[model samples]
Target: MMTDTDITSPVMDGMGPHGTKVGLLRVLGPAHVWALGVGIVLVGEYMGWNFAVGKGGAYAALIACWFAGILYTCVAMIDSEVTSTVAAAGGQYTQAKHIVGPLMAFNVGLYLVFAYTMLEAANAITAGYLFSVVATMTGHTGDLDQRPFIILVIMFLAWLNYRGVLATLTFNLVITAIAFVAILVLFLSTSGILGGGLMEHAALFEGHELPYGWIGVLAAMHFGLWYYLGIEGTTQAAEEVRSPARALPFGTLAGIMTLLIAATLTWYICSGVLPWEYLGDGVNGSVAPLFDTARLSGSNGLVWLLGFGTLFATLASANGCINDASRAWFAMGRDKYLPGWFGAVHPKYRTPYRSIVFLVPIALIFALGAPLDQVITFSILSGLLEYTFMPLNIIMFRKKWPLNSIKRGYEHPFHPLPALTLLTLCGITFFAVFLGYGTQLVAMIGFYIVVSLWFHFWRYRFVNRGTQFTMPWPKPQGY
Candidate 1:
């Protein structure tokens, strides 16, 4: 008889009907795991992004994040189920392969590559921007543009992740501490605004009156949508954690809830002090909205803390992105979709060493050259795609096949409806971003989707031809 904790046990890593071992490790805990998920939601930059969405945008953000949280909270629950069922390393792509088909899985694999890789770059570049923000606030703003600093930040982050998870967790703890303090300082100095006074004095939209239209709502959502981008990422680490059946869903929901509280408070506070009109300038506006808010609010010390916190936050998120992205790459490589090099795990670290190395240069170029708006756009594209597909997989699995046989601790209160609602909302959000940003961005994204599909059929299909990719279909179809 095999023991439960045995690494090779079918109960732990699980086995296909054909008895192939899908090696996976269970190595994470609740606090650290929850921290990773929540951290992405409370990014310090939202203070500015929320403010620009006009006066009403704050309320809209609150509703949006709250509802989005509820929707993705379900997504997390469903993802936890999939995590436990497959217990394999590939995560979303694994489920995509099972539910949709191999070709579709290959497409998801490609999309995950695009999404996470760009996310890594976005984190690094945002860190660099925060660096300049802090420097400027402390009167140290230099002549250099942010690209070089972004490159350096990306390199450092890659090194930290390359070291190991323990080191990465330690770094996360420190950065989270720093971010908490920055938030505390902002609360203290701007406490006056916290007691609903800002709401009491919130001026009507007088400056450059664009008439609060759908454009304003979409712009706000585009920026605010960043808050909820990586909601399911923590669940990807469920296998790496203890009692994931309990911990994964709890951590996922708890993480989003915590960030919702923290982020809402921070956004409201910042708006209370600086107001939205002043936050949107032409030149300086695009760059340092939070720093400017602190200055205008006469809370320079608090502003400095936020600046440093943002730098740290950006780096931490960047590191997490590298970890997730590289793993995704490794997973795909193992499936023989990408080049064989990506599957080569590091001997010492036991991580995706080759994938990380490959990602670094791509990250550097993306970090150093791409503008923030473009980065944000790419992030939106990747994020929304993942968000849409993730929930769809859950619904399809639950309805088509009825995987109720799987043991899942936590579940969304509403079943198929919540998932459907989330998918619809995501579609609407994507359309809104496309309209607000204009056709050029849409065309570029469209071109990317087209090319990615072509690559999947023409390139990856040929590569994985001999390997029979099995998907669990409905009884009428075939499992």
Candidate 2:
């Protein structure tokens, strides 16, 4: 009974309240809105070591924010343009298929899967870390190991996403709000103790050595990408957005800008309260940096509260990544770049059951590979590569062959300038990751590029051939 149009409609069947209603109108408001972008960046802050390394001896939190603003702005613009054109579920893969080519699109899709899967794994590992912190503070251990903890978290996240977008967003809002409060409390406590109050010393106006050269600035920009990694998550929800053309772009840009400012403020206040020396591997490397700060500030009660808050933040970030990655797979599967199973929606839940099942093992492997900072750095580096390609896709689409058939909703303010700036920053990020992480990172990246290239040429055969194995593109929508 399902018509061809129904299969590809903006509001597909499944994934609604009671599994009956269409679920495309789950417009994310400001609360759940900020969570998507901000939560991603906050992870680096919660895991303080990365911030310390990137921030160096200089207190450049504010300047870092300024630079983050620029980088995120470009990412937002490029994501918006693409999401508007193909507002269905296929996210990056869908856009790249249209602009770049089916094979390149497939590669990007796979990269996203790997990136987000690792993100989820990282979160699950952090969850165990948070639980351990709470246990250590409360003086109780309930037989919880990291591996079991990871499995439980993944299952819970899968259930949450399966419930519906509205439920997921609502939960996201609550957790994100708590996380925000935790951040504020962290800043205040850190400032109250240090010689200079949070505002005076933490402002990061002084002591930064500006990279005198372009390469230096770019090098600095490399470590900073983690501060703005999740700016494009909003695009994954394009199907549910009120106006894909307008809302997707606006929401994405707004989210990135907001996160940039918040991260700057957090770094400033945190650095001011506690010197980098006090934060060691346990606190900096663990999930509850704020709790460590609370303990150092000599407030036991606040430390407990911060423990709860940090747990919430880590869970939120992990949940968001899991949800986003599954959707990306669903989109690609729907396009026939991936297996048909991934494309199939659960008849009742309206969620991508096939993709979720496929994603679980990958996430598990990533979680095991985790437990090290270098692993996280590598995962984040790959993500930067994805971000870099986004702007390139926009330029390619415009110059090589325009997607004029698609209606435009939101366009970038500065045309190619923003895209060009984004392109340059991404190059900086690539080199910085290379320098900071070294040869292993390079080998990893080389592997990714080679794999991506292989799949495109051999697997899909450029989608235009209308292969029966691939997901058939719906008849072009009537203009």
> Please, what are the lDDT tens digits per residue for candidate 2 over residues 305-403?
677777777788777777778888987766556655566776666677778778888888778765656556656766776777788788875664344
Point out where model 1 deviates above 4 Å.
1-25, 44-48, 51-63, 136-142, 193-201, 204-210, 280-283, 286-290, 297-300, 438-441, 452-456, 461-479
Q: Write the per-residue lDDT of candidate 1 for residues 1-479, one digit (tens) a residue.
A: 21122222344322343233433344567776776665554453443355334423545545555655555665676776665554445568777766666666666665666666676677776666666655775687456487778778777777877766656755775676577566656665666645322332246334533435545654555556665666566755644565665666677777776666666666556555554555543134434444455556655565666667766666666766776677777777766667666666555665667777788998777777776567666766766767778777877767645534333354455577767776887776776676566664567568667877776657665455424343222241244
RMSD of every prediction: 4.3, 5.7
How does candidate 1 fare on TM-score? 0.84
- CA lDDT for candidate 2: 0.63
- Clashing pairs for predicted structure model 1, backbone only: 27-240, 28-240
